[model samples]
Target: MNSIVNKSLRRLYLLGKTVRWGMRPCPAGARETRLIAGAQRSGTNLVMDILERSWEADVYHESDPRAFQVYRMRPLPIIQELRKRSRAKCFILKALCESQDLPELMEQLAPAKAVWVLRNYNDVVNSMVISFPRTHEDLQRIAQDRKLGGWRTEGMSEQTYRLVSGLVKRHGDALTNASASALQWYFRNVLYFEKGFYQHPDIKLLRYEDLVTQPQRTVSGLFEFFGLPYHPWVHGMVFSSSLRKRPAPELLPEVAELCEKLWQRFQELEKPQSI
Candidate 1:
């Protein structure tokens, strides 16, 4: 199929870029490690793809085995070694799964900075239900505290766990995939507030809507945060077609109310630094 061929060609092109960038001479002085963190389906991929197009930075996607294992980021020591070896001035890494540990990770990887992206709950839930059919089932276990072992439940504050558990108890198995995915969004994103990220100077907040609608301004602000100069190649890599493209899914009344409150909170917190 043409789609498959196109995907293959894209991978080859990216590989060529990575290989060529890796061989460049290391710039003088220390290299800054930049991290991209967010909940799944929250435009992290788009951001990473655009960043990868930059010749001044070296990217280590979560799928990169050198920095990740089974899509989760590898240990800090391994990441440090990779940072040390990269020749670029900025060593960029994507760590969505390890978002909960970012505060500590940033401390350990000092001279590091991060961007935590936020997206609309309705859109994120829509994408989750379609891309991950088993999400509802997985979240049921997470809500009931039956599966505390997975990354979904990791670093979950007791207060957050109780809130999600109570919601599941109220609706029982009657909860729809949309609502479940929304709760997943809540639990993961609430960590931004619960972990005191609002006070963290090195971690910046970015909105998915802003990045898509105003790509140049938003990304220029992001690059400024990372202390990297913006390049023109990233312009063609982002488009606004995905903005509010999907119909909002049917969510339970309680879940909808909960997500709206959290969404409003993010809006308030993100106002001052709007690009």
Candidate 2:
């Protein structure tokens, strides 16, 4: 009970802080406000690093502890305000918005631009499974969303519990050492965003290979897409940066084939005429 009470208090405090910060009036960013969004194990960070160095923009990554870039740490309004006020020619930021959350995030933050990075499916899923194995923490996040400190049991209906439990039973195999969840996750987030968010006028897509092999041309196009000046120094930064590192599990051949098909579709979708 004490633990539950503490969580409640924390939520209230966060809500209060958000409300306070949001009430103040601030202008939206004049330069393009970008959300560097992609799959968890994809090359979002690598892309952000290159862009940050090349454009010399005010770049914020998932590592920003003070702001909690993954969740609502300093509130969306606060981040938007800071982005507008920053001295950089373009202010770039990122958050983890996958599946259904993408549209809601765009509606709230209303970024003028977005960069979606894609990686090979097998590599992405393998890396995700290795880096983020299934755990109790995953369910705890759902409980937090429910405004409860614990999961499925404390203040949850049996039906709700059953629903969640079914999902885990269907996907979770922590004991099996297989990554069914990662497979589903890849399809869900990748296809969902590609079908929904890619249609948005402000969004841009880039393949991981393109960014690494043809860094100058790809980044120059990104800058042009966002209406920012292409800098000569960006080439140096790209050359200096490292390339993709795949995670442990031997990639499945079937997954690789599916991923290639998706990549081809992605290329087809990227044509300016499609948008």
lDDT at residue 64 of model 2 (Cα atoms): 72
Error of 1 at 202 (Å): 0.6
Give me the candidate number with maximum TM-score.
1
Top candidate on lDDT is 1
Q: Output candidate 2 Cα RMSD.
A: 11.1
lDDT of 1 by residue, 118-191 (tens): 99999999899888787777867776664653888888899988888888877877888888899999999999
Clashes of 1: 0
- For candidate 1, the 10 contiguous residues with the lowest summed lDDT are 266-275
RMSD of each: 2.3, 11.1
Clashes of each: 0, 0
lDDT of 2 by residue, 72-142 (tens): 33577787677656555566666544323445556665555676777666566556566666533554344
